[model samples]
Target: EIYYNDTEAKKYAGNSRIIEIQTAMSERAIELLNLPNHPCYILDIGCGSGLSGEVLSDQGHTWVGVDISASMLGVAVSREVEGDLFNHDMGQGLFFRAGTFDAAISISAVQWLCNQDQAHHNVQRRLRKFFQSLYKCLVRGGKAVIQFYPENGQQMEMISSAAMISGFSGGFVVDYPNSTKAKKYFLCLCAGSAEMNYTVPAAKGLDEK
Candidate 1:
């Protein structure tokens, strides 16, 4: 496993080619967000090295970033995007107050939550917290665009159910076809509204005895 705190992860911060791809995708995603002309509060959940921040800033949105890895956030802060940065784990409830943001985005991060079959159960739990927290933090009619890798339909269905149970409406699911260099990517978008109660499955224990 690549240590997220390692220097190698930080090196990706300065990779122009990678940055270009991220920027392009972010721009397209933001367009789908359909933000108002006035400045809006935007959160980049699991933001790595501020690549999203760059694109959000360029688009004139007020952006903030949160990441679990300090080393990765260090590289993000070094970019000096005009927004706040926090060291945070998305699995935990968001610390912000209700209706704190207009929109939220998470890209290429949710798959990290899936480790094993039991771990996949944990992914559902974490995603429930994530969707609930995002719902609480977004104003009515606000949007959330999340891009994640789904191994198959089962995993994708789990995520979709979590979104609805977490109080989001008008869910949109899109599948990106596999490219020459990479596998397919899945994008899920949902509009936040009232809160709904959800019970996530618990992870199976390792001990057989």
Candidate 2:
């Protein structure tokens, strides 16, 4: 919350490079969702400045966004984004009704769950609560694609394991794995029964292996 102060929020929302990358990542995350062309209700976790939600709006999907930073949400409100915005700390867990959303997406979020910023912060417990709540909120067969910059393999494993423990079945999809600047990690997840095989998307002209 402190990290994204008013000045920083304005700066972040105004940065062309940040906007471009965020838009690209949001588009990629939506692609991984593989939803029908029809509009669907979606959840945007850690939806800073509503940048990712803008992509959802452009695709004709209705969405609700939650973020921890008030300043960031201020920017979102000022932008008059279509999605409803909530100032929320996700680690406390989502309180949406059961099967409330058709799908979910998080861009450059989730990684914060791994960091223990305070004495009361338990990474494992928080992650478990988050995934469980998210799982319960999404409809059966619903999917979520979370794009994050993992600091290391351990963080990636921790996040994935938490999702599986919450009853989600899916795995990672790395895009542009060979390029340092362009490389991205997406945790593609499916809620409830796995009726379809979860296929990892091939890296764009790069070997993920």
Candidate 3:
């Protein structure tokens, strides 16, 4: 399922509705930043075809896109004329220096790291590393806005708990479950904070006992 080249990536990007949804999500996430200047450095993790970059550009924000897919990155490079773009993996940690960005956004990408059975622990570890990198890459009071599809309540808890443990505060979670599709989408925003210790309750249906 890896999009290995520009043409293959473009096929997926041609779906206007999905592109619109990704754009909407990115716009909503950027709205929460309340940044103070033009040319703000915004990072789009898992950027594909520059859909999010298009929205950010419309809002006058300077953006950088990163993704592991070469095809996807190539598509992004074509469409994201207004911003810098990179090919990188989120799981390996961001390459930028501390305080290099005003905000970061991830759209519908995190879930690809692992599957539902191993998601709880796998996602937590990945997110912890992500948050740590995010913390270093963003200025004080900067924000990371992430959106993904979680299998259930337990998955959501794993994500929130990881944020808290990673020294991020002001945590917020939003869930939209589509019953017909049997899927749940989650959006989380966490702010960097001094305190790093917090516990998340065991999710009610986690073990299915």
Candidate 4:
């Protein structure tokens, strides 16, 4: 498995190149979420070094982040982010009670669930469990914005289909589809409700409304 231990975690947080990439991705994901103009609790899945949580906190939302790597969590703890941090694997699913959060967000993390990290690692089963937990954790009409890089069409379909089966509405949103380099995919989901229209800034000019 590709472990994010202390040194790796330090580089992830401190390296100039990596920090920019992580911060950019986090900003884009939050932009797509179209959060309401109010305070709420958010869940940051695979939050490494609190980059995404920083964005959420800036918007005045309370958040709790979870990561599988203890070293990553340690780095996040040291960052003094306003959010809480937990060291846990998403594949095993979240342990929070039902309807515990107002929204959830993930960045560059869900793709790892597809890996056969161990002999017993089953991607389909694990993905279902994760989604089920995620769906239950959000209040009715809550949202989840997960940004990921799918290796192929099959992988993309698998992720979206799992979320749908877990009771999430909505699907992938691809920005800058014509631009091969800047293209980004965000899985936008609504819990137990229809997808609402998100006002993409006219300046960004995303093809979708």
Candidate 5:
């Protein structure tokens, strides 16, 4: 379903305004990840067109990316992005070895998993499996910042509840609560101790039209 438009894929293959928006949204998630100064490996979940991976590469961090769309991954490969790219349905769970990534980030992707496209496609089960794999893939202190748009309160609860059941330090950060265009919702999860707390930076100037 994500591979709905060839023109959109082609546009991403080159360079365009959509990528700019993706990059910007992903940057916010990366900031929430809060990696150390030294280099670390990252997992870019739903890393469409490699735009978010570009940001990670620019930060001097190595990364691996996974997406459900072959067309999108094709575009990413054409860009010669500095990361390994592969195909995977996140609902089925990631295939990474335990503690393989320092951190993980997903931009505007998780919400898609909520769609019940198939009779066997259970949303809650899928969400839990996704988070379970994510928790295993991350290092002891690794955190995942997923930026998503919830259609309603039910989705938000279901998603958050799944994360908690999977054992993520349960909390979500809201960016630009006042803004329309720039508002973002990040579900923050930590694989390590529950005592590890962070102060999500304020939305700041993201609200400006």
Candidate 6:
């Protein structure tokens, strides 16, 4: 909220590099989701300026976007994005009915849960709450693909552990592992036991020159 003020939000929305990177990441996340080509209700966590939600909408999916920054949502509205928007903090937890979403995706979000913004902020507890709510709101076998930038290995481990503890089953997918600039981390999580056999897919361009 504070960091993404009105000016920052507008700049973020207007930046070509940011839009390109965000679009590519969102597309990759959706690919990892592996859902059929049909309309579904989706949740976009930390959907800043609806960049990722726009991708979801492009796939003909109905999506609800939630972000802590009102400024960002304002930008999204000004852009005439199609998804429903909400001004809420994900760390507190998603306040939706059980099995309300068919799938969930986040682009460059979720890692904010690690920041100890206030005196009462507990990183682990907040992560647990967020994942638990996400788990409950998704139908059994539903998946969530969250793309984030972890500051360190420990932060990545903490996030994965919390998701697993909250009953999500899946792991990380690193694209372009060999390229520092192009590398991206996506935590692909399933709400419950999936009918299909699941394995951690290998990283893309892992052996690229």
Using TM-score as the measure, the top candidate is 6
TM-score, candidate 3, is 0.78
Per-residue accuracy of model 4 over 97-206 as CA lDDT, tens digit each: 99999889999999999866544338888899999999999988788889898999998998999998998888888777767677777888888754444323322436
Deviation of model 2 at 43, angstroms: 0.3
Minimum summed lDDT over a 10-residue window in model 3 is located at 198-207
Global local distance difference test of model 5: 0.84
Error of 4 at 121 (Å): 7.8
RMSD of each: 9.2, 1.9, 6.3, 3.2, 2.3, 1.7
How does candidate 3 score on lDDT?
A: 0.68
**Model 2 score (lDDT):** 0.90
Q: Pairing residues by index, what is the TM-score of model 6?
A: 0.95
List clash counts for every candidate, in order: 0, 0, 0, 0, 0, 0
Give per-residue CA lDDT, model 2, range 115-173, as digits (tens): 65744338888998999999999999899999999999988988999999998999998
So what's the TM-score on candidate 1?
Answer: 0.81
lDDT of 2 at 202: 55
Please identify model 4 stretches exceeding 4 Å from their true place: 118-121, 194-209
The total of clashing pairs for model 3 equals 0
lDDT of 5 by residue, 1-209 (tens): 56535677787656667777788888888888878889999999998889999999999999999999888888888889999998899999999999999999999889888865754337778888999999999998788999899898888988988887887884778777777876668887788866776444455455465
For model 4, give the 10-residue run with minimal summed lDDT. 196-205
Off by over 4 Å in 5: 12-15, 119-121, 197-202, 205-209
- Candidate 6 CA-lDDT value: 0.89
Query: What is candidate 2's TM-score against the reference?
Result: 0.94
Model 3, span 1-209: residue lDDT tens: 45456666878878888787777777666665556676688888888777878888888888888887988877766664577778777766788998898888888887666553455566567777876787788877677777777767776666667666766665443423323332324344445555533221121122232
Off by over 4 Å in 3: 1-7, 116-124, 175-186, 194-209
lDDT of 6 by residue, 1-209 (tens): 44599998998999999999999999999889988667999999999899888898888999999999999999999999999999998988899989999899999888888875744348788888999999999988888999999999999999999999998899999988888898989999988865544565567888873
Give the better candidate number (3 or 6) by lDDT.
6
User: On lDDT, who's better, 2 or 4?
Assistant: 2
